[model samples]
Target: MATDDEDKVLLAVCDVIKGSTLLKAGRSGKPHFRQFKLSNDLSRLMWESAKKMDAAVLISQITEIKTGQVTPVFLKNPIPQCEAVSFSLLYSDRSLDIVCKDKKEFDTWTTALKALIVDKYDNKEAVSAKLVEMRGSIVSEDRLEVQLGTIKTKVLLKDNSCDLYLWGGGDRGRLGHKDDKPRFLPNVVESLLGQNVTMIACGGSHTIALNSKGQVFSWGAGPQGCLGHGNLRDRYSPLMIDGPLRDVNVVHVACYENHSAVISEDGNLYTWGKAGPFLGYMDDSVTKQTKPRLVDALYGTRIVQVACGRSHTLVIDEEGRVYSFGINKFGELGQGHDKAITKPTMVPNLVSICKVSCGRHHSAAIDEDGVLFMWGWGARGQLGQGEPKSLFSPTPVNGFNDQPLEDVSCGYGHTAAITANGVAYCWGDNASSQCGVPSSVYGELSSPRGIVLPSGIRPTQINCGANFTVLVTSIGQLFTWGCNMSGQLGNGEAKKTFSQPMPVESLSEKRVKMVACGEDHIGCLVGHGWVPDEEVKSCMACKKSFTAIRRRHHCRQCGGIFCGSCSTKRYPLLDKGHADPVRVCDKCYVSLSSSSNIK
Candidate 1:
């Protein structure tokens, strides 16, 4: 994966603008070390760049940093009014600019900005060493402790008196619980006690995690060996995936279908999963593996980000080139045809993809400008294409052509996105109300449409399940709608699905930072105000479904009338009042009964 010399390097470098000296440097090619430093004033650079480009003045201001606190520094002069002003930042470059009204404003901000600079420089040595160590390790688990995605895993940390929240499905622990007994609430995993965990991911059934120490651990299903454990056994607990990948620190990890990918501090990519061409699984005969292996094909490419679909994988190189591989059954891989690739193939016509998400059958990418592009399955409107016909290549979603999309996520048959201003929109099949908006359209939409939430609530993140939707707000509130079967919606009922978003009462007062959805179960990561009790929330419908219970541990799955904790106290299913009652798992309950539909 050697790129031409012209390819620009990308790395996440914190750019600090303070007083006289604005310094920027990050892990370059070698071991973690400060390789580049810039001493010029950011304000002067901004004005010069704007003037040279024939652009109007656009004042740029940032709060001053004093004693590790951010303080606003107001300018005596007003900001320049211009037709357009743009701001851009690259991971490695750290160069910045602002074209604004006058020198007075710049000077005033500069004075305030100076104090922050001195503070940053004073702290640079310690932070730099930490950054280098991060850049050197192959899988930096510490950075992942508190990640967010569609499905979230929460393990309580008694030491910190807080719960560790992780999102994204990297393993079968899709419920986001440390274990898999159909957890409905975020609880302490016990196994992860004492150690501070920040993030977790599930791919297919496999799970990967990062700790406060910057280490990565993985477990669960290893189909195609996505667990990176170097074995195919279903790990009931978390285990470290591998050692330092190279002289790099892993900053992010993404899981799709059965493949896993990670981004390092220096913007390098390392992946392990299906043995395909682009995935670098050299064992031509072995399609899957049980351990994490380096993707030699991507060496030196400086990958900034990655994503996975059900059977395909995506990598965004620093130079904005997208590489794709794996199954292209529906042309979801974006490789120009339904040709399955064994190696990494450059995705056609995709550049500056700031974010990417893959559904069960399709894929979506958001560019740097916030315009969303979708491809793959259009059936049930998962692609938002306004038609049932599937797409073989990337197509721009029309409704947001003018407005920039802040983020986008896809489900089995739907898609949702948030705009830059915080408006959430959805399109495609509303069956089970997964779309969050009412759409009689049975299939997909060619344009994006808005999804209404309870008024005055703007969601910061969203996740989609088989036929349901979950939203978490900046204020730590949780809302859900759509298919409520099995109490997945956590409303203490087995009612029909909703066509619009509704708050989940059981999780009220629980500041939910993340949410994860399984095919039927759901899990959320709580922040502040969540009750720690494990009281059973009964689903009256489930109660009626139960006919008998032969074993202990709640029989919600078996339609048993007793809660798990109460199952042992009952005389099984022998009661005369329950004569001829039937027993089955919770999943079977959906098949045995029908209830009145609630709007």
Candidate 2:
């Protein structure tokens, strides 16, 4: 991502700075100058003199990179009495302020520190890239990788043997049937049979798919070659993406309205389509990458995941740090400034962001601790901050102290989330009844409200689309509400709108493992060549409801849904047409234990 000279400067940031003053409130500490060195592996930042090791903080321990004096000590001492070019390092519990010798040195130290936090770039590249510092006056830089709402596929599901299904608007070749006819119900994509497709991303008009072999396929109406077929022509059948993606194992793919990107298993990122700055391209001559091209700027970084809004894109690295690029007019980048940039700039102050979702303008991310944060456009209260106000930085959604959220989805103007306990909440624009609330309830919600679901409808995954919502239960049931203009609800209707959650009866026959939402279309991935999730709706013996945490188990012997208590034992049954654990049910466990043929 940087030249050798810049890498050296970033790796060799040896400096002495005036420290102190900026501790937590009610703490006492004196200011002093100390020499500091970044560890060779760039894992730790250590400071000391010739005699003693003052302190050593893991680079990952620093939660935020801040600028200027902000502590009570600095309030009393004032900037006139201290170094004006100073920055602060905020950890989980404490903060350390360091003052540099001059403006150049201050920029160098701050840039190096921010880049090292994301584990990329150096001071010069950071400056050129415009770092995302929290301070209002300071600028931020970028490293590019982005995921779109089209493919905000969570990693919670690892099963890859899934069949592809599609419904809704077939215009622009979205249904992948080589025709522009609408599918009013869930129908299997016969062409994708036996492909073992693991994931699917439904974009505004195009669709991208990835199979178990790491092959990526795309079709539908592509803007600026988003389909990656070397031209802007729309495709009706899934075509394996080649060009720069040829022979590359694409682990992840994201698509919004007009752009698309993918992360290779080897940690390399490739992007196509049209996103002026958000596309993370260094070249200024090319307006659109008609073919998928490797993003040279973020070449070596390990991007774990990505999400994209209408025009902006956010990428998360292996360290769980957040980075953003593209348009920031509404502060979707969470860089504390609205200026758009072309590189992947670190989103400061956010720690261990594990999941991210992008709406038409807003963005949401969940930390490892399960706290949900929202930023960007909030004119419709999509930020869920109890008010319609845009946030330049990531802000935690209140009222979730007890139960953390496990899944989140952002739509054109609405948002949805699922708690760890299976509770679903919706907030933001309800004008089209997309917020899971009837139009009588209000045009928009300022805060999240529990969605009134039908009996036995506990959601394990929640997804939002242009003007509709999709929820998947533990048993593979799918319920939809809001806009059905294109028969996206999969209920054999095209002109109706739903204010309450309605089951897509056509999908009740199979087990839905994953779902993707496009502007007016839908894509589903179901468990293939196995017992459908629908068959395991309840425990065969107890008949209890299944939730996100209280999962339904399958009996290895009879293949019936059983509670954990019923299938507590595992026994080999290779002789009975099974290889691994053939008899796990209570009866099978007891019988296998008594059988001398168990060998």
Candidate 3:
């Protein structure tokens, strides 16, 4: 009797091959073998006659078959100089001899015939039921959750789970765990262990979380009333922000520098914290809004998306019209003026917009035609317009006109976009390697250039932090480049930079669904099957033993284990995802510095 595993293999092979093959025409008076192809449903096999040609055989019409038949061969030496397995396929009207390359091939054909016989008369319904069960099981394993923080720390939150994990910097209650102690490894937020948190966002020194019920929670530095609790008080633990927003079903939230914004399901937008002219209010009477307040100017317009810059805000309505209100020191508002706009004013000449992104001092947008528009600070070429001059109004990025972008993102001083074909393009500051290019080529890219990756690696999503970039591929693989000062790349290293995209090996086993970045930290959502690595006891490069004094360190560039002595060098690495100088091992230092030709 065949084992269950063998039976499964046979069933799979039969389902894919289905016994379709080339057969010589005997009674049809043709010298050529006719090719038969299976229909998509596998119910029938169609073939063309050798002369007039066009015939088909239905699997349901196949009768009993005999194997190893040598008498009454259809053609003499069907395959020249090769041994072939012959069998008789009995149909309702006639019998035909089928020749195969070998016994293995003959067995495959026989197995498919047997399966079709059984399926046609005995187990068709049973097999269909089993397939449905298998499909359900596969779908159950697909749910995933991803979270990201800044260079100072990291966070991880899984879907359908209530626990929020935090690591790295814990200053000013940014970790949301009621303490200021940094966590070198992931630690659960005991307070939110069963709260069923759904989303998380991080800023310079603050954290915000949204639960399944749309309730908003915030913590950390509130110097500018970023907490949205109606006061400039810092909370060491997660505190629910309730009041006007309590009854609203908030769907999305974003944070920048000392400001925060939330959008409700009904298309309403609320903002708080560091309320200068940037929060859509021009009144000098209010410089800070400790509580979430509705933008009166956008009272009737339904906002579909919102993004925040350091001191500015951008909103898109249901009609694809863009509105900007905030500081315009570098023309970030794209309003043809350098002065601040106290109201949500329409960004002129921008229509059919589909997506928008904001950097610390610049903004980017993509339209229905896949055209990219950029404005604001361009000193480092973040605008991608072939120059470092700032734009006071929305200007089309002509370089990408031929590329047809699908998505675009902006970093503090760089910009990245993905074309419809999944190719990634980046431009702007290479000072810290943020542009994924060498500074020796050009300190800043005045125009967009392609970012090369290994074959078969196609980016599905891209995001930029203060100085680093993160990408997630179609197969759920995560890659990071630019600066790595705070281990934001999640590569387990602390190298100064990576001039190219490198896989985050720690997440090799886990299916990463989402990733977010901050100035010094990263957060990711992954499937439930992830396994943590054991602690390293030796340097990955020199094999030096690690002691209490000789602590274990990680190379930011390669994400390898290293000792303090082996990882003591620091370099201004923008490509490894850092905005400043970061410590790296000697190997990475030499490679990164030599590539850029910086002594």
Candidate 4:
């Protein structure tokens, strides 16, 4: 008969492994007296239970026989001759016995014991029931990562390769890489590694990038000190600007010409960049600030958003208060006075402002009650007010009779918006067919016109570039319209312009995460192509034109451009070259011949 400890192992291991292996002994006595062997370490109580409880009576009343010569009836394996085993007695805490066991038997017993403990301790349903109770609690230590823009279709192409489409690469530092170079293909931008970015916006040559952390990074032309770096120096990399910004986290940022504005988490407004009399409170001492300055006039009240025009700013507060400031030369401020405001000033009777967007020379806003408002230069009906020319203050654009607005975006001289369900509409100058309205359908639209999309295309997000419009679909497709010069559409070719949205070719696989547009350049974040490889290419940092010409025989050392006669030393790194159409001067050729072999 097996001891109590051996009985437990057989109970657990036999059930778990399901008879894969076994331990049995030949009986030597009628009582099946097989010499019991326990592991080197067994609970004293267990051994004592077996020894003192009439299972075995010993001279010392020892519970377990330690290093003892127990006569073996049946041994699982050859027992170790010298190892000691601790023993305990039943109903006693002070006495113990030693019994020896084989090393293999010891290991098997240990495994079985652990399985038995787990079976005894775990209650499956009880754990599941407790987890369900915690699900209702809302306080989460982790925050949700949200983004605003959709991916561009032409951001990546087939074969897992990159083709960066870069234009306006000269000025705003928009390329985010080396300047003084024109990048024709959409190349990989390696600076955003490990960063979770949500939105990107560009104004002329300046750019503003917002990450999930609520921190804003900007670069590009800063002459108007539009970069907010506090100084006028141009920035090549995205750098954070210091300000009074905090928990009232920033959600959206916009820049126009040389000015920038941002909407905070709490809906307060902040403006910086060129400040003129039209901003209100006109005074020589306080007009302009290169850094961000809070619009204290609307501080206490929550303002939903702000938009910037070429020289003016428009803000709509939570209670539907429309505020206008800055250059009103075209009467875009809409204060009804035809004068610019140097500080925040309320626009007379504006109410229920749901959304507001600005163009190069005009401003448009929609009320919560679904009424469209227009002011300033309405040239070619960008104001959707039926007539061209200026409207000094807030005037309702006739046609929306009673339709509510969901969102809005402004272009250089036009505007576009989407309804709650997915219908897109546009008004304003369709000069490059950016409005998606047929070119033959001329003149300004006094009312909103529907944009016809391809049969199955539904836009997830929409963006307006200088004179173009980009639409991103929920299924990761990108379609673009308007001026395609410089291949801004990423279709591998440039067109004078397109009248309707056209699908970008070959990209249905790469997942584009985000896109940003400058005056003539486009930036996008693409996935899955950062693998490493080695290839010899021209250095972006050096002048390629200077190294194009070669010398047949020049000193390999010092790069003196002298013949072999003058070169005493041979340096192969700089000396190796090809002999092309023209023969190199003997003096220059001989200079490179010394020490280095002509290849």
Which candidate has the highest lDDT of all? 2
> In model 3, how large is the Cα lDDT of residue 363?
96
Candidate models: Cα lDDT each: 0.53, 0.74, 0.70, 0.54
Task: Give the higher-TM-score candidate: 2 or 3.
Answer: 2
Best-fitting candidate, measured by TM-score? 2
RMSD of 2: 20.4
- For 1-599, candidate 2 gives per-residue lDDT tens digits of 66766644533343211121111212343333344556544567776433565667887888787777785555554333223465678887777666543344565677667776655533443433332231342312221221222322111122465888899998888788778899998877755654668888888888899986678999898656788888888898888887777678788888888788888876788878874787888556677678888877787788989787778888889989888888899999999999987888889998898999999889999999889999999999988999999999999997554688999999998899999888999999998899877777689998998888887778999899998999999999999999888999999988867888988897777789999999999998987654447745676556677777667776554445567866787753322222223436675566445432211
lDDT of 3 by residue, 1-599 (tens): 75654565445443433333333426434223334444445577565553465576777777766665443454443322122355666677676665443344455666666566555423445446545555533231221121112323111122433435554456788777688765543444545533446666777778777765577888888888999998888888889899979788787788878689988877889989986877775576777899998887888798988888898999999999999999899999999999988888999999999999899999999999899999999998889888888899999997654878888888889998999888888999888777888666667898998888999998888888788888889987888888776666666656687778888775676566666565665555554331122545576567778787978766654455578888888754322224234676777676555534311
List TM-score per model, in order: 0.59, 0.63, 0.60, 0.57
Model 1, backbone clash pairs (residues 3+ apart or across chains), number:
60
Regions of model 3 farther than 4 Å from truth: 1-169, 177-198, 528-599
Q: In lDDT terms, how accurate is model 1?
A: 0.53
Q: For model 1, how does the per-residue alpha-carbon lDDT over 1-599 read when each residue is reduced to its tens digit? A: 42431111111111222111111111221111011122222232232121245312211333322221111111112111210111222222232322211122233333333433332223344335544655544231221122123322221122212244333232355433445554433343433432235555545465565543345666666556777767666676666666545234467777755677777766766777766654655347666755556666777677777776777777788777778877788888886688788677788999888888777878888888887888887876667665666888898886754778877777777788888777787776676767765445433444567777676887888777666778888787877777776556766566677777778765576567666554465545554222232342442223423235522233322322333433322211111111122343343333222110100
For candidate 4, the TM-score is 0.57
Per-residue accuracy of model 4 over 287-352 as CA lDDT, tens digit each:
466787677766777777777778888887778888888878888888876666777888887887
Worst 10 residues of 4 by lDDT: 572-581
Candidates 1 and 3: which is better by lDDT? 3
Once fitted onto the true fold, the runs of candidate 2 whose alpha carbons sit more than 4 angstroms away are 1-158, 530-599
